[model samples]
Target: MATEALGSQAAAQDRTAGFGRLALTALRAVGRVLGRVFGVVRPVAWVLIAATITLWIAGQSLGWWELTVTAVVIGAALLLCLLFLIGRTAYDVSLDLNRTRVVVGERAVGALTLSNTGTRAILPSRVVLPVGNGRGVFDVHRLSPGEQAEELFAIPTSRRAVVKVGPVSVVRGDPLGLFERVHRRDEPVDLFVHPRTVLFDGQSLGFLRDLEGLPATDLSPDDVSFHALREYQAGDDLRHVHWKSTARTGHIMVRQYEETRRSHFVIGLSTSPADYRDDDEFELAVSVAGSLGLRALRDSQRVEVRVQERALPAATGKQFLDALSGLEHSRARAGGIVELAGSVAASLALASVVVLVCGTKVDANDLRTACSRLPFGARVLAVVVSPAGTAPSLRRIGDADVITVGALEQLPLALRKVLA
Candidate 1:
C-alpha cells in the first residue's frame, strides 16, 4: 500500500512539470509576436496609442463624456493602423538596364516592372530607387489583381563613374500620413560610364634609336627588310639563297634583312585627389590616359594601364575600354604618383615605354623622382594636364619627356608634336 501511494505521488509531480513547460512555451510565442508588432509601429502610432490610454484614464477619473468620445476616436485610429500594418501586399518587382556600360554624356535607361500577384487589388504606392548617393522616386498607380505596370527612367551620366542602381523599396502609407511602411525588394545593378578617348596619328617610338621599331634597325638574314647578302649559314632557309649572288661570290649566299621590334607601352594614371588642382584636371588626366592607352592597343602594341597600386589586365579592343571606364579617383591620399611609378617600374621592368598621366599640381621635381625609378633604356613620358587652359608645351625633365596640356582636345596635337 505505501509503494502504491509513492508511485501515485511521483506520477502527479511529473504531470505538473509537463504542464508548467507547456505554459512557458506558450508565453514565449506570445512575447515574440508582440515584439514584432512593436518593432514596425511608427512613432505616430505610438503617440496615438498613448493618447488613447491617457484619455481613457482621464474620462474614468473625471466622468466626462467628451474625454470618453476622444479616447474612442484615438483607439479607432490605432486599430486602423494595425490593420494596415498586419496585411502586406504581394508584389513582383524587376529592374532591367538597357545597357550595362556606356560612355560619358550617353543616356542610360532602365525599365522597372511592378506586378500585383495577390488575389486582392493593391492601392497606390511609391517606389524608391537608391541611385549612387541619391534616391529616385516613381509613383506606382493602383494595381488590380494580375495587373502589371512598367516605368522607364534615365540615369544621370554627367561624369565618369560606376553608378549603382537598385535595392528598390516600396513605401506604403495612410492618406493622413499617420503611419508608413517600407518593403525592400530586388538587387542592385552596376552601370559603367567610360571616359572619353581620342585618336592620334603619330609614331609611337620617341627618341630611342636602338629600340625604335618604325625604321626597323635589328638586321636578320631572312626577315622583311632586305639588307646585304652574307654567307649562307647551315640552318638558313634554302628559298632565301640568292642564286646570282651565290654564283658571283662562288659561295652559298643568303639574303640579309632587318627585323622589326614590337612596342610595349605601360600607362600609369595618378588618381590621388591631391595630385589635381581641381576635379576638371583629374578628369582630363583620365581622358588622356585612356586615349593614349587605346591608341597604343589599336596599333597592335602590347599595353598595360596602371592606376595607383592596381594594374589593369592586359587587354585590347572593348575589354581594354571597359577597364578604363571603371577607373575612379582614389579616395585615400596616401598613394600618389611617386609610389605608383615605383610599383609600375618594379612589375613592368621590360616595358618599352612608360607614360605617366598626372595633373598640374605635380611639379617637375615630382616628375623627376617618378622617372628615376623606371628601368634603364625604357623611355618615359610625363603628361601634365593643367586646369588653366595654358598653351601646351614640351620639355625634358631628367630622363622623362614632359608634355603639358590644358584641355583634353589638345592631347592629340600635343602628342603629335612631342612624339613626332
Candidate 2:
C-alpha cells in the first residue's frame, strides 16, 4: 500500500509541474510578442536623446555633470520602456463569493484574485463581473504581479425566484489605457430568491371553518347516519317504521335519520369583465381562491378548482404557489360561474357544493336563475371578493348561500361556511 501511495503522489506532482510549465510557456510567448512591438518606440527614444545632446552643446559645458546625468536618464528610460515594462506579463484569475441568498436591498461582497504567472508583471485594465440588482457596480483598477481584491455591491430583488449570475470577464489594457482587451470564463451560478411573503396583522376569519370537502357530517340524502324521528307518514317505508319509538309515543313513528357522505366541493373562478372593472378585484379573487384551496387541502378533503379558460395544472405544494404567483387579471370571459358549475357537475361522481370566486357582481335575477339550475339538494356558494372598500356582507340568491369577502386573505373562512 505504501509503495502504491508513493507512486500516486509522484504522479500528482508531475501533473502539477507539467501544468505550471505549460502556463508559463504561454505567458512567455505573449510577452515576447509584446516586447517586439515596443521595439518600434526606439525612434521616440532617439528623439529624446538628440534633444538632450543639443541642450548640452548649446553652451552648458559648465554643466558637464548635468549633461552626463541627462544622457544616463534618457538611456535608462528608453531601456525600461523598450525592454522591461512591456515584457512584464503574468496571468492568473480566481474568484470567491459569500452567501447565495441575499436581502433585496443588502450589499453582497465578492473577492477576486488575479496573478501574473509570467516573469513580467501584468496590469489588467478592465474586469467585468455581473452583480444582482441593487448591488452597486464594482471596478478592479489593476492586477499587480499577484493581486487579490474584494468587490462590494448590493442586490435589488423585487420578487422571489432563481436568478443566474455570470461568467466574469478579465480585461487587459494598454499602457495609455486607450484600448481594452477582454477574455471570459465560462462559469454560471444560480441563486434562489424566496417569495415575497406578507403577514397580515390582527386578521379574523370565522368563515374558514366551513371549508368545502367531502362532507364529514350526516347531511347527504344517501347517507346512513341517524338524523331524527317523525310520525309515520303515508309513503313511509314499512321497514323504516320505528316500532320502539311508536310504543313509547303510542303512535306510528318512523326513522327520519339523515344520511351523511363525503362533501363534494367544486370551486369555480370567474374572470368575466362584467365581474370586475378594477384589476385589484381580480387579484383579490385569485388570492381568495388560493387561500380557500389551501384550507380545504389541509382538511384532507377532495376539492376541485375551476377557472374559465385559465387552466392551472399544478398539483404540488410549491407548484400551486408558483402557479398562483403567475395569476393575472383575465377578461376573456371564456366561461362564467354558471358554466363552470355545469362543467363541474358533469364531472363529479356525486352531488357537490359549488363555490364561486367572482370579483364582479352579476344581476340578482340572473344569479337566482343560475342557482335554480343547480341539481336538486346541491348547495351553491357564491363568494364575492369585492374591492369596493366596504366590509363584507352575506345575502341569498334563491336557495344559494352568498358571502362577500372584503380581503383576499379572508377567503378561507368565508368559503368554509359557504361550502360547508
Q: Which candidate is the best by lDDT?
A: 1
lDDT of 1 by residue, 267-345 (tens): 9899998899998998889888888877777667888888886888658657766777777778675588898899888
Clashes of each: 0, 27
Q: Please give the CA lDDT of all the candidate structures.
A: 0.82, 0.58
By summed lDDT, the worst window of 10 consecutive residues in model 1 runs over 206-215
Error (Å) of candidate 2 at residue 187 is 9.6
Q: Can you list the residue pairs that collide in candidate 1?
A: none
lDDT of 1 at 379: 79
For model 2 the TM-score comes to 0.46
Report the C-alpha lDDT of model 2 over 186-298, residue by residue, as the tens digit. 47555544332223322112222333323344443233556677887787688888899899989998776554435545567776766675777776676666665554555
Where model 2 places Cα greater than 4 Å from the true spot, the runs are 1-265, 331-333, 348-351, 369-378, 409-420
User: Residue 324 error for model 2, in Å?
Assistant: 0.5
